[model samples]
Target: MRSSMTLFSTRTLPLISAALFAFSFSASAQATVVDLGVANGYSAFIFGNIGSSGSSGFTSVGGSIAAGGNIYLDNYNVGTNKKPGSAVNSMVAGGNLNTGWGTLSGSAVYGVSNPNATLTAPQWFPTNNISKGNASTLDFAGAKQQLTTLSGDVAKLQSNGTVISQYGNMTLVGNVNADVNIFNIDASNLHNLTLDLSSLKSTASIIINGTATNITMSGGFDNFASFANRTLFNFANATTTSLQNVGINGSILAPNAAFSGSGDMNGTLIANSVSSINYGHVAMNGSGFNTVNVSAVPEPGTYAMLLAGLGVLAFMRRRTPARAPQAAMA
Candidate 1:
């Protein structure tokens, strides 16, 4: 007679292994948690050019900068406002790099040849840390696809906050105890509307989705520094985003928009192109997205294999005959 313990051991071992394999495969399928990939290290990740012309306003970046097109900086500063003792790549451009008077506290990398690129009166930390032919290492093309997918996924999330409008001011209120909160607002009402986010908790992940193809925001957000790291403003369908005179706190995700803004932003900025970003003295900080939820799903083939294994185990258990007792021997 086959012992019950032997049957259980043989059947349960394979099931456990199959279950674990499926779980691991699903966990690595798609990431729900927001990840910027290669662009996470940069404060400003632009798919197109940086400055419109050579006479653009002075700009200061708190972290690294990566641009797909040419980078024209009249008076600029990079890798200065970051962590105290960290010196990474200050500037990375896929096109030419034209600078008049600026300071790069780290290395500089440009794609074009010497004639198309110029670096004049720029003070380097390690004394002229300039290089060429490393633009492909930044991988701006991969970042664009990743950010676009992220924007779409985040926009599809369910809204969990309330939007109240009164006297040209909009207030977004969410539960403090929730892990993730989403809010949707129209792009038309964004201009000149004061945003109130004082009721939101600092530890929670906040996502603000816009509903327009062209967005122009000119308002200010209150109590933004508290939840800046875990907050994201997703402009998924925007073709052009104009942020004028607004002190933005959360990270801006506009993968397909031409971003033209004035004033200072305190988070990561991702855009398709930059006509001009007049930051004056104040610039974008490295307050990037630091937290979010991640969902895991198994592939169809792995799921099917697990189901077949279970079915075979059940059939074997059912087909097994019981052992007969011999009482005449006693």
Candidate 2:
């Protein structure tokens, strides 16, 4: 019902504030610094999709960031859809896992930037296998760029004041000072999220089907440093689709960044700094909230099961006790 992330802050300045209104919604800001206080007005505004879908049964993609101590938001999609040769016809629907280990379904549509953009099955419907669709298969054909996933670990000593950290993945395209660590988790100093190619960034349409993998984006000995995985950057004209799990170690910077995803985050999330979650809109019937708890470490039951199985096999092989040596008979 709840997620593991925490509250965040945003700000903007005077001149920077004016510029935010000038941005074109065709894509994200080219410059990593989303100056919300600047006065740079938009010549080509692109934020036409921002507002709660009133029974439209679909969440409109949107985004925002802080600059010069001001928050700036103007909806924008992505650079390229992950689904290659697929359709970009925007659709809607839902119901998914809370731990983020499943596929999503319903009417997930897509749109692309140019005819060259390709769409793939994994990119279009990542939760396809571990999950299902409500109406039909996922159709992310038109998406220029889609937020795949935002996960990592704190690269420094995080505290209650800051709820962000350095997250290394396909989304790390710019020089973003992610200092929004809000999760108040106290545990082993590190963050390890099961990763794979699809979990990373994508330059072209990439299909990711449970290519179960592991990657250590970053971590440290700091208490909250393990949970300081908040705030991300999406530079202007940037694409890390070919992004794989990498390492991270950095600090929080002003003018934090923002990113949007095609992944179903269709749910409401609540956190007290322990953990955070991301999923689709939470309907009474639809599944929502993929939790990430920093306090409780999952038991290594898999390892235990494997060891127990091995012991059973060994016992069966040696059904009788060892016989004593008969050297004295000679």
Candidate 3:
């Protein structure tokens, strides 16, 4: 009968290529997506070993931590207040920013506004305290805005514009480093990451973690201090977002909620190091030390070969035998 069905379709095409190579080697061992995005437009800069202790008022001018979206600036202490156009420093935070896109965990989530984030936009979003106003031009791209709708359909949206920054005055830890950015594509799961900076002249610490997942944090954005981010943690979202310099090792757990997805990487976003992160809380430029946690790289095993490629695809479909004889015997 047609040469025995052409010899059973050449032995079921080599058992369907060994069940798609054991389901692609168990999906490369599950959990794959750590690029922390970066490349096109380019961004990522880290420099540690910050000393010069502070307190009486604040001054540790040895910070150095940057990532970029375009690396805007309202203040970098250029001449004395990042001159040029002006927006030099101003904050009064707000909240609500969990639009789309997901997967982000490159760790760097310090602390600030935790007094229940009151006094309206207290510092500089989600949590990190702020409030260096008077300029009223600072804009971290409106913290990567996203409300959209306002005209009906989806009902009542509004927001509609912004890439990152709004209000202003932010510089996580200064003297220098604090220029974040995030927007790499291939779109897997990760949306906004508009971390604007330039004003911590008072207090603004943020040291989050990596190995990201569903996250959406937009804590009240004003800028000042309260001591928040020392608790709320959870990294594991197809990880990777490192500039290397893991201060504050494992067990990072503060950041109760945040999420966004649809990731790509063609945009590049490669520097790698999104793993170690502990509860937040730092004052650095404002004073508050204790940092540890160097470079670490683990999680290799390929998810047990993707669950052993599902029993090798059910033993190659039971050795592929019947195709029609009673529909393969039901």
Candidate 4:
């Protein structure tokens, strides 16, 4: 009986271990949703760090500005002053700033209120009434992690006449002549991808496979206005992504990536670091732009797997008999 019990223990232990392993893997593989928190209050600009060379450009940001690093606005105009909904928005910075001839219209500026902090424009929110650190209140790290997870999650990929090319660590999915937009990408499992939209009218929805990958966009997007309501770009797996002279239509989710661009983006920009140079402008979507609402519900498949594992463990425990008590002789 003792030998039989030992064998049973050994067999059951391995089965339990396997079940636990599967359960853990399923839980970890479950998708993660990022919460922007108060950072979403700003509709225009959000960045982990921002630096710029002094240049005069007619760049306009339609939403609020939140920065983890110092903001250097060199001859730039932020926020509309006349629009009824456009009350001077909020500007929250984790660090100090030197507004060099740039104007920001908002209720007030929040964050580190150093005495030496220069503010050329009038502030509705007094310096003495500074709020908490904007960067600390935000979960940039979690967002980046979500992106990394997304990179590991690939749904499906359909290619046309395009040839997948590799440039060092980067992967290019389309070419100039090929109608690269013919490829349908189900981002549910897409890891890292660099899509060339040099000759495409529209692109399919890209579900993010959150991973620590990088994505880049080259060329222009003419049909962006059509899909402005849908999510056009999702780089939840990328650490860094760049946009060069493209007109973006949908929401872009790159919570971990440092997004730098010189084009006009018409959507939500969520990232660890965001910067723009050479007349780059961000125009938020009126309906679903810069709202800090994220629901991280586990996928149905994940829930099913988890439940099945638990059920197996319960059955195994039921099958195992309890040790019987031995009677002592007087």
TM-score each candidate. Answer: 0.72, 0.18, 0.23, 0.51
lDDT per residue (tens digit) for residues 1-330 in model 4: 767756866787677768768776765565333333333344443445554435322255555565655565665555643233332334555555545555556544544433344443335423443344444444444544544454233212223324343442223243344322223332232323444445333533323232336666654443346545444355545677766656566556566677676666655566666656555744443323322212234556867876787787677668777879999988
Whole-model Cα lDDT of every candidate shown, in order: 0.71, 0.22, 0.24, 0.49
Superposed by TM-score, candidate 1 places the C-alpha of residue 150 at a distance from the truth, in angstroms, of 1.2
Off by over 4 Å in 3: 1-6, 9-11, 29-92, 95-253, 257-330
Tens digits of per-residue lDDT for model 1, 1-330: 467646665777576667767766665665577766666667778888877565442277878777887787766777787753222677777877777666777787877322355443344424357777553467667778888898898877667787777778777788666677778987454754333545556567778899789887777777767777777888999888877777777788988988776767777788887766444333777746775774444556766777777776677668667557967965
All candidates: CA RMSD in angstroms?
6.7, 25.8, 20.6, 10.3
Q: Tens digit of lDDT per residue, candidate 2, span 98-181?
A: 111122322232222222222223234343333223223322221112212111222121222212334531211111232221
Give candidate 3's error at residue 185 in angstroms.
32
- The TM-score between candidate 4 and the true structure equals 0.51
Mind sharing the TM-score for model 2?
0.18
Candidate 4, overall lDDT? 0.49
- Which of the numbered candidates is closest to the native, going by highest TM-score? 1
Q: After superposition, how far is residue 219 of candidate 1 from its true place, in Å?
A: 2.6
What C-alpha lDDT does candidate 2 achieve relative to the native structure? Answer: 0.22
Q: How accurate is candidate 1 locally (lDDT)?
A: 0.71
